[model samples]
Target: MADFKLTYATMFNPPEELHAGFDKAVEKLKKNMGQEYTMLIDGKEVKADEKFDDHSPVNTDWVLAKMQKGNSKHAQDALTAARKAFPMWSHTPWQKRVELLRKAASLIEERIFDLGAAMALEVGKNRMESLGDVQETADLIYYSCYQMEKNDGYIVEMGKDPLVGYDARNVSVLRPYGVWLVVSPFNFPFALTGGPAGAALVAGNTLVIKPATDTAWIVRLLVDCFRDAGIPDGVVNFVTGPGSTLGQALVDSSEVDGVTFTGSFDVGMKMFQDFGKRNYVRPIILELGGKNPVVVSKNADLERATIGIIRSAFGLQGQKCSAASRVLVEDSVYDDLVGRLKETASKLVIGDPTDRNTYNGPVVNKSSYNDFKDFCEEINQGGGKFLVGGNVKTGGMFDKGYYCESTFVVDLPFSHRLWKHEMFLPITTIGRVKNMDEAMSIANDVNYGLTAGFYGSPEETEWFFDKIEAGVTYANRPQGATTGAWPGFQPFGGWKGSGSSGKNAGGHYYLPLYMHEQIRTLVK
Candidate 1:
């Protein structure tokens, strides 16, 4: 609260003091596992007849929590509650909303370790990624709050009209949509949910958040932070269940003023098309999955490119929408780059997420694990060669969890479906191109235009930046090639089929998406 700065998680140099705290928090959370988590509807806890268990991706036997399986009825209840609270909440002073958001962020920071632990178990992200996700959530809230203050509460005064007998004062005020529904994905549950929810709330809209089935536990933890920050109960609602039932009901509900979703492309497109069928036009903010690529030129630093591609491709087991799933290497240096990438990837540590030294964790669930295996098998059978890793590691840490080695494939045709489609697993395909032009062609050929990375000379970097079709791009970044976007620093979003609205989160256009412009003219 002193000076108001939101810093990223320092995984490499975490504070020694916080180390003990995180360890204690994880243990405490583990003991509380398997407890039933109810839906927060209209400031009251409601239980459903059916329930589902949240299990750790690292070990299915480990039940993180038991959550109520929300249905269409519960979704309607949430919408009704949000609509009932909308008038008072929408009229609440912008300064007051900002105050509450800041308080929420601070409270999240206070319980960062506990939230991190929940994320680790729920999403199978390593300690660093887990901690970073929670911290980023808090920062996302802060960034939205900052945007509100910087824009003067989104209330603009227009020029006055002069006439003989007419004195006209005109002003434009950005007003909130009635009620919003935030649909979050499994990966980055806290950040994705909190970021959009924070923007909607700060813009004076009440929300009903439905997290992915795999991440309900972590979502519950985040909702607690908002409740503790003095957000009125009905102002923010939380529900958990399958996307087919609960999510569809929320999206199809006529009561929802606007919607924000982050998930697969098919579902997002369906939601977009469905929202259009309403009687009136409504805004839909979407961040769909990406088949992102990275181009490594002949002039690139092979070591830097190797490290960047490996980290970006395998981070979070490549579950991220912005993960680099394709690599195009210049013909002159393609072999060298591929060899180094294979060597480095084979050395990555894959194990339980709770271990501090683990770099690669299990996939989010068994379905993803099967996807990893099937993709590798199909690629191998299609005459592609495994550059380094292709086998799934089993019988130890991987016995109960969904674990697979980081896989790199080569000699596959560029036209193959595996190369064009998104796998959303710890798998990457490498191909050789004649030059930067060819590399750029391959990178832009995919349907997704989300995030991209490039390593090349200054002229090539400029050319890449100018020609790349992605919404987010980076050049010569060692932290990550096509991933590692931080809030405020990099407002993360997608383009083309990868996103619905062109606006990126944590940027200037985000909060405005939740608002509708009202022009006022007064004659005195």
Candidate 2:
């Protein structure tokens, strides 16, 4: 595997050794299943009065782990620990912080197989996608450290002021905010949590991380890596529980200096409004859900468009914020492209994601499973046609878990709410357009501007890039239409309602979001 590099775009054809390693890790993980796990706060193991059992979406009969069900007190305790550690952590030299973060990234890569296996069972992602998430987390941290080093710890010598009979010196530095709170979503739990945590820590701030209820176990393993890398006590903390009690407490705390949250738009907006009620404005970075679209031109390559659309639409059961939820094709080749997509999507294997041959997996949990059914029913009532799949998979192994078939709909009116709403499931809507103008108009109509894909001639591709409202845009790529963003290669984020800071993660501009600028002037 030395000759190969792994990224979401490249994971489609990994070496045989990769599969062997994953198989071994999966076997080892099975033996350790159903253990009780505790939360880490201020370098101590904290247990809650109540606990919840985490069941695998792949097979609910298998209890993945027992996790602590923390309350508001635990959230405050974690925040307090981070606040207390802020002075020492914020004063630590940036170089030392970068060193520590790099070590943590190394540990993630070393444990990639184990982490990936647990992610597959817990998050219902396929082996390759799970491994990619783990690898991407490490790469994101590495990128943050690289940026810190490249910018010389964000310290720059500025032009000195000339004063009569005096020597003036001026310098500028970027300093960390106080304690930071990271609230991560269920999908890509490792990367989203670790990425923000790494940046906050490297920027000289302390942290308190809270994972989504459905995916606390995998995140606990991630926090372990940071602790094992010798991050100072109280500098990084982890908590688990319901969002209403624990997560809200963290957000409402006056002690929190900043926050980074990745979740649905409604929830994030509420948090943003609540956080704004503080005396002063605090930094709140958000990656809200997306209603991403794919625009295929009349002169586009039909085969490439079909593959990219199918992969982006159905990968991870289309639970990604960057998933291609809507496809707008030119009328000239709409039927051809739709037929190819239907044929390709129909052949996708669906079952336990841990299986080597499976390309599609179960939805994250029962809530999403039921939502999928409800959405399919709504589409049927609205006079939409199912091109491939629009039903839940039941009986046999699927009966024990939350499983849904990949679904694509067509002929729904443009005014349908489903066109703009984020389903966050294995459902995509495809529509025909009279021309590129019509396709582009409909694609940009949604509030989300996270990611978009285009397939067309050179001139038309250029037009799409110029006109699309999304932040991350791709053209004629078979790997994925709107998904498969890699750190350092394709820094992922959103625009408009899709994101808050207008900055993409794992790129040159992300680290500074965790910090503020300070200028020093001296005269003698």
Candidate 3:
């Protein structure tokens, strides 16, 4: 177990010890269910006037935790606390900041299994995916710390100004923005929340984290790691509630210096527009959802292509932003690849995610379950055929939760809007292309350029790389066609409408997004 490392790409073949630890942790966590949680502000347990029950997607009758229903006032209180702590946190030495953040990362790793169990129950991700999310969050924080140390705190000595009469010196320094807010999505809740939060804190910014309503329990546990790591009082705060009151309040506030939001395209775009209305333009980093695509060439390995497509299209119930929602196959092998994809998808077990045999689980909530039905109806109305699944599961345990079958649609015309929409469900649309050129044309036609996958010969792989418009691209890998991004290995982000900043997170350039540069000069 010591020699083995875990990543989304490598999670398929983990050590047996890993499974044993996860099972033990799940048993322990089950005994502590139905506990009440509170929001964290100024390092104190703050309770709201109203509260909401967080239910497990695996079974709706199970109340995982009772969470606070934060309002606009609570949002303002969190911002004020973070704003007040900014001076002390920003002034702390960079090395000290790194030390504390690293401690927090270590805490996350130490509690990986416990957090993983919470995530599986809350987000409806299978055991491996849930564990991978927890481990990835720790790695992301460690990566940011490594980046901070590698760059020597982002303070660089520059060349002296050319002046014969006087001695001159110049230096460049990157500094943090104040009161940064992180609004994370339900999918990969741990990584998305803690990744940005770690970057923000390690860069010397104070934080206020707001997680998705459906998955606040896991984020609260993550916040506990930071707080337990001895981050100064008020340096990091957590708030949970509906997006309309609490989330919008945090976004609309002029006090927030910057923000990192991960969610839908329309909501992100709306926030971008609202930020523009401020007195001065402020930094807003966004990772909107993606309608990712995968292209299969005629000469590609049909077996490898089918395996990769099925994994990427159906993993996490296909709710990932990088899910392969569109698969364009060359006309010669379209039928062959589609048959294999349907066969592989049909074998994925849909039940409680905590179970060892379960590969797929229920959708995150009732809203998503209803959306899946609506989207399937829309596809059928537009002359699309379901190659695999198109109905909701019922009877027994399925009726106890928000269970929906993994769906693959075919014969959907290119003219149909579903071809380009981001369904964010276990629903993928397949299309046939006459040639590689036609496939590339259709792949790059969408507004999203987040992640893409290709399977073909060496020369064709190079051509696919040259032609694809996505930020993250993979070629001929059975692991995942468009999914599985690690921190140092594959820095994940998007382009065009998929992301606000061009720089990908967990990469070389991501840590700097939380900072602004200043040049200092002295003459004698």
Candidate 4:
């Protein structure tokens, strides 16, 4: 497939030529906005009786696209389609499956610019982050393919049993679940959608992907990539609708064999609970929300910690589940760390996401905007100091977009609701700790344990890694404190209440979860 090798988007210090191309691509997509899209079940487009308007989080005045409002019936239809295609697809040779997925990855690379443009507009992600999300999706698919090849299609011959000395043979094979339902989140929609979906397909399972309401168009692009690569009809289906109607239908179905979900803790946990009510146990892979933390020890380098904390706390407008929402600093470095962090936060550029220089973008929608405003107000009322930003930005482009300042607050107690909850906004709470021990205590005190970061010396860093209760951890990383996880480099997952499955996505253990083991004994 044209000598494909997956590489992440190089946004920093990128050649001027790349920027020129991206700018043109954005213009092209902007002109094509407002088209209507429908559900894809069994290779046909099925329009729903109801439709929803998708507006740009960057500029709500601009209609990005129209999506079919999928319902229970649509979910059932998609499931039926998947089941219908399962026999042939599951029997397809693993080598053939690998080739088709690789072709899809190549197709995604060919259309990377276009997809990135759509993502930036639809998700309010800056150019770099949007492009990274698209590239990461392609990488994730390639990784899954690589894993399939490495494992020899998960078909292995086993040793003969001691009692089977009379000419007996044993073999093990992993077989796909009947139908896999993929429910993706808005942030990193392309990657999260493609990653889990790829894992399922590579393992021979059929998929009925339910894209987030806001990101249906992006998923449409992804489905096209798979279809163009020659995946059989009904093997990969796409449906869009509200969670109350479509989501509930998919989860309630006893026919669905497995599900991969990425979203809020409340919803993910509920799905985990409901999936268990069936007559038999059904596999559910979930990456839920996180109230991640970053600890700056007394031995930390203040400059490094400040920059890392800023990036983690505000990147993607701090919408990432792995974003650092709480920062616990040792008392010795607390003043310096807070001072530098506020300075960096104040200097960060906030504007249109398509701009190459923009460091922050708008929140996903009006609800998030209101939540950010209310959180900042509460912090102020609780006598916390707003060392940098505490208000939303309005007027001009901000009038239509859900724009807000990347905020920082101090003097909030560890028991504050803001400290313990996941705001999913560009807000970070800073508190002082007596030492590394107390910092660890405060960091792990939250219910969620998705991701965490530490800035300290080698000894302290080792201790942090040993003691931290997160699934994903980073130390002294300038790119971010808890953010910036590349697929192959860091397999992402969560611990405690942040996730239902212990296996990390894009890691070695992920694909096995999509299938169940079948042991065969042949006596000769």
Candidate 5:
């Protein structure tokens, strides 16, 4: 019945309605209810003095009551809890743990809508987009179950080495670190969190999720969903705070055996540095900032390419770590491509996110919009012509929520800093490259190498594929038109500045982060 503002400055409070079916079920199962939002430490709730508001970015719709703003004290609490729980969790029978993960996945499937609503309100995504996030998260949950169960070492087998008569060993067994600190970003909060937590839980690691302060309600909802699946307390916990304090706690905590982060490069690198301060470096998997580039080949399809480029770069208001900020087109097709891009970009309705028809919603807040706007100005000052959109205003009828023109610009070099740094908003820079080599040269020039796409013939695709340097590369496509980050395969993390290790999210390789592998030998 009540509405709230969605921005960074607001405070999040848990309200009564949060318990509709979500809370009642927890109580029916005799789950503890109405505990002060606290650090989940050693499988228990410990209170915190600080709290922040979880808001709706779409409008000034103030949703949830105060979200717990975590501090070093809270981080210590969760780390302690994870430490105590880790020994048992790490050694927990992997098969049994796998079943628990399946339960978690099922719980998500049943309560998708409840979580979806929280996502829609908190993060400013529309109904369907929120659902997509939830579904992506749930798919990851289900995959985590199989990932652990079907892992090489989960089932025993025999093998022989060339020098040894009979050498037999399972590939590797998964073990939980005593503690893991998870820092999740605002975009795709559910899917992002679910990927790691599902694997960690299956591998018997306890998780302390520091979800984005903006979407704490979704985090709260996710915690309850896991609880519904009979996950024990402290196995999965919540902490809402600025990344600085909490992230430092994890990096410095002796008990925190590992950490997984999905956010900007600067923050991820800071954590990596902190992790290095100790002798035994905790595992740190960072899915960081991306300056993804889309290369439109001379022979590519413009109409489809336009739609794909818009969706790829601007979807989710261009707030994703993998958002395509740079658009490199072959000069032969550059004019037509830029014109079509501007035409389609102009049609995107940037306004109140609640309206389903609104394609591009506001950025997370004014700071993001201002940064994007300033970036556009800087580009314009550099002599780039604004083909369409790109004008932004603050402090008017719409003051708090952030929104940018579905901006399109041309004449900027592909190597411009505007394309180099990640701008968590919907702005595209269309650059013209003279030939295939020029396109490849410009595309691979950025420091951050997350994902890139090439639209051309099979030979040109092969040529670019061989030359372009990136973690995730696509061919004959406009960039982000496909689903699940990759076709059939979910979005993989990138390398260079893009990702810490460049491991794909949904593939079988994700388990190695939480679980350390060792091969033992018996000789006679």
Candidate 6:
């Protein structure tokens, strides 16, 4: 197939003859395999007659192009290719695999802006957030490579234990989970998808990837980057379709040995139960949604506190799993901070995320917009008053877009479902607490414990550090600050529906876990 490049711009550009018309968006996405999108199986391009239309959320009228959609055939092909390549890939020299992963990392770094822009257009993330996501994704690649380079194939010994001073033998090894299925989400598509993909690939695992429809454009584009980095054919496959269909196709496949998924909790539980019920399952690592909390203290610096909350709570339009949807503030500073928060939030211009001036963007689609709307109605029904923005109204065609107004509800009852729920929208609920005891009570009340953000004096910060039931807790930080994975490290999943495994990603120490060990006794 001849090569062709596609460009997705951040700004609203008028379409050209070469571009497809988008009533809501410009031609921000185009997939070209021999001049148009075609699926790849073992490096061979195959066209599908049916197409999937991907939209850009920047404008409601712009209609992104319709590209060939994958079918059961694609899922089967990905599994087939992975099965065929598994033996060879798993047997590749550790050093060679490490080198390949490093190369993939470098290639991703070079295309950071290119991929980030695609996200801003197709995925509805602001430039800063998009840039952060792309970088975090690429960083995972490098992190996996570093892990691979340091892989200790295994361990064996004939020595001491409490009961046995003399032992016959001991051993350890990392065995690949044969064929891995990575199904990513609409939010943080790159980072969530990239973490598992990079780790599974560099660990000598052949894999299939199915990203959310809202953002598969970037997923496919990144696959190209992997190819440019010399990733072997069939070692990585990209597919997208109805989740239930595609998910069942891979999970039920006899050849698939593992699954990595990031999305909603209801779906996650279904996948988990199915894997168990089928009894034909492999390992499944999931990153489910959470009602993550952020706390503000009486002694905290309101300046730092406000910046943190705004970005964390509202960044990504509150679509982040780690987005600070719950807030517990000390009564001493509650009135003043909420007032100041109102001031800061009011200053934010909610509009197209692709624009340099855009601080907010439309949600992924109309459904997410309604989710925000319905929840706000519930809050208002429960006697909460809106301090800042509360209604959804768009002006002009651009205004007609799926823009959810920034919303904050005060005076919500602690018993309301909204307080404990994970609201992945622009709406946030801020509560006032009397002291440290009340603050801890508020923070620990939720079932979701993925992450926490706290602003206070060192001692006050320790209150959360000690009592907050979460995987991540940041003190004296902004809302959106310290929320993602950096290069050369790992970010783990949290308790109570966040994930099953302890190591979420970049546990480079576990390369041996995905490997096989052989032991032979030589008789003298």
* Candidate 1 similarity to native, TM-score: 0.97
Per-candidate clash tally? 0, 0, 0, 0, 24, 22
10 residues in a row with least lDDT, candidate 4: 1-10
The candidate with the higher lDDT, 2 or 5, is 2
Q: Put down candidate 2 lDDT per residue, 1-524, tens digits, no spaces.
A: 89988899999999998899899999999999999999888999999999999999999989999999999999989988998999999998888988899999999999999999999999999999999999999999999999999999999999978788998988999999999999999999999999999999999999999999999999999999999999999999999999999999989999999999999999999999999999999999999989999999988999989889988999999999999999999998999998898889899999999999999999999999999999999999998999989999989999999989999999999999999999999999999999999999999999999999999999998899999999899999999999999889998999989999999998889999999999999999
Candidate lDDT values, in order = 0.89, 0.95, 0.95, 0.89, 0.69, 0.73
Poorest stretch of ten by lDDT in candidate 3: 273-282
Off by over 4 Å in 3: none
Every candidate's CA RMSD: 1.8, 0.7, 0.8, 1.9, 7.0, 6.2
- lDDT accuracy of residue 204 in candidate 5: 79
lDDT of 5 by residue, 1-524 (tens): 15732111111132334324433442332232222355455555555677665555655544444567778888777767766666666676777777777887778877765676566656766545666677677778777777665664354444655555755443444456657777788888888888788877887788888887776667767776777787776678777777668756756877777788888888788878888788765678888878888888888877767867777777777787666778888888888888787777778776655454666667776567678878887888877888877776456635656667777778776556776777877777788777777777777777787777777777777887788777777765443532226212644768677777656777768776777756555544
The C-alpha local distance difference test score for the whole of candidate 4 amounts to 0.89
For model 6, the run of ten residues with the poorest summed lDDT: 1-10
The better-scoring model by TM-score among 1 and 5 is 1
Position 111, candidate 4: lDDT: 89
- In the range 368-480, model 1's lDDT, one tens digit per residue, is 88888899989988889988778888997689999988888999998789988888988889999998888888788878999999998988899999999988899998778
- Residue 329 of model 3, lDDT score: 95
Across 19-117, the per-residue lDDT of candidate 3 in tens digits comes to 999999999988999999999999999999999999998999999999999999999999999999999999999999999999999999999999999
Q: Assess every candidate by TM-score.
A: 0.97, 0.99, 0.99, 0.97, 0.87, 0.88
